[model samples]
Target: MKRNIVILASAITALCSCNDGASDKAPVADSSEVKTAPENNKYTSQPLVTHIYTADPSAHVFNGRIYIYPSHDTATGTPENDNGDHFNMMDYHILSMDSVGGKITDHGVALNIKDIPWAGRQLWAPDAAFANDTYYLYFPVKDKKDVFHIGVATSKTPEGPFTAEKEPIKGSYSIDPCVFKDDNGSFYMYFGGIWGGQLQKWNNNKYDSAGKLHQPDELAVLPRVAKLSADMKSFAEPVKEIKILDSTGHLYKEKNNDQRFFEAAWMHKYNGKYYFSYSTGDTHNIVYAIGDSPYGPFTYKGLLLAPVEGWTNHHSIIEKDGKWYLFYHDVQLSGKTHLRNVKVAPLVYNADGSIQTVHSQK
Candidate 1:
């Protein structure tokens, strides 16, 4: 999804040294010193750390601790446009903690854009999976021809100096790769985003600079799903489009911006059901749908999160110590869209298994 270009002078926070998974002394800032975001509402959630800017957090529990994989935001002075030119992020830093709001460790740079041979620029959102005793990091980046491709990297530990493969995954395009592993030991990836994400340009399964756009009366662009091979490197089958239906079980039309998919696809299971959540980009909301199978014609449930103090919202949900937490990012630290900070808050589920609406604050 496209982000707004709002830049401001950054306020530095006090730095502290901590033990990282890589055994490197990574710098982290005192969370108390970070400024509250410019919002009218009070917030209980704060940035996990403020020493550096991070966004699009994909957090997972590994070895009884939480590991976060987020895009390392940097102010490259590039102007913003609908094409997402200003988000000049070139690397990834892994964050881990024993508990939420506890001492968090910055794992240093896990992967860099320069290290990937086929990558061009803008290493956007990424996700991690642990399978076959190996940690796999899945990410999306534009190649030399400026088309987006999803890639995978390998590491022995959750916090990593990952080694990238020589090329992107075959038959993969678009951005925001969320790899979800099932209880049966199968892995599935849910991804796709419009606008700068370039999903609209791939209507024919290939990129066309002058692609046709869906008419307002047509069903909106659908998020894609594919099963990961046993090796967890390539797709096991052809990528298929996912259908999102309204509460009445009807497909969402293109004009339904507030309900249609934009970007940041995430899947988490609870009580034998698959919950597919994503951002409604321009409307600034995180919504979800529920289905019996991971490959779903899911029926829309409702809003998981309302609008925050930023133009975009991306998130991940995980259960820790019998409690659920939502990890997300906002422009609270730098007051800029591209320079974002990660935050976590408790997520609640009603007795009926429906998620309670979350409203983020400053």
Candidate 2:
């Protein structure tokens, strides 16, 4: 059953600003549901589960076990369009596994759209984080006005019956909220998407439904990032636009949809460098960039994962027991673009630190 959350404006303000002095340690998974698998069988390219559709997997290692927070895809029969109307997801489910190629357990209904007081519909892709000894689930949904906003929920366990805050995070407009906890104990949220994600409409900091993407030569629409407050419930400061540049320090133009940011921002630290990877929506590629800081003026590296068997793809990268794995999704199961299933495979990195691209099995 879902837990009801009562949010008090005063309590939220205090929690968002207070210096709680809690350790920024990562969450330790309960051994009851997670076990260690043998090292011999590690890599896999199979769907995590097929009983139900899921997509945009955001994977993490909590206490050495893999936990996936994914968008629960529902077959609502809504017509597909450039605005993403066909993805009529209304809830989220949490998936877990002891290792790659091992059995996956679906912890059903971590959160539902009906539980969120301010949300109207469409519970799109979500990400999870652990801090202050609490598990946080960050998601994007449309509000009463039909504008997308990022909202947060909290729980004590990694697999959650999470209780959402009464309101959406202030100044958060767009989709795909990936919260990265830095080694320095700071948290950063990277988010935004074009088209149905509603990011292009807010280029001027105000919503204009007819607002279009930049010209072919102009600086393309960039993703947004902001540092989280101590409590991880709200932004500590104003949101800033991330600058993704090319090798020669040139901004990727709007016409370069194959290289420009469309949606799904994920950050993982590798060899002291920050890797920022995102999807090139229409072009059907998963590309990345590298930078010295989390908030990057990053230089484009290259494709991390090539085109998959669907119209959209989103993923997460995690290092477990010295091996890296890429968790992503495709429509292989249902053969419909809006219905996708999550899968995993080994992600290799060159000695030079560049990712060796993995092509999906169509």
Please give the lDDT score at residue 273 for candidate 2. Answer: 97
- TM-score, each model? 0.89, 0.87
Question: Candidate 2 on 1-362: residue-level lDDT in tens?
Answer: 01111122222223212211111222223211222222111122445565677799999999777899999887776888889988889888798767665556777789999999999988999999999999999999999999999999999999999999999999899999999988999999999998899898896467787888667787779999999999999999989999999989988888888899999999999999999999999998999999999999899999988888889989999998898878888775566788787777667788999997776642
Model 2 error, position 73 (Å):
0.7
Most lDDT-accurate candidate: 1
lDDT of each: 0.84, 0.82
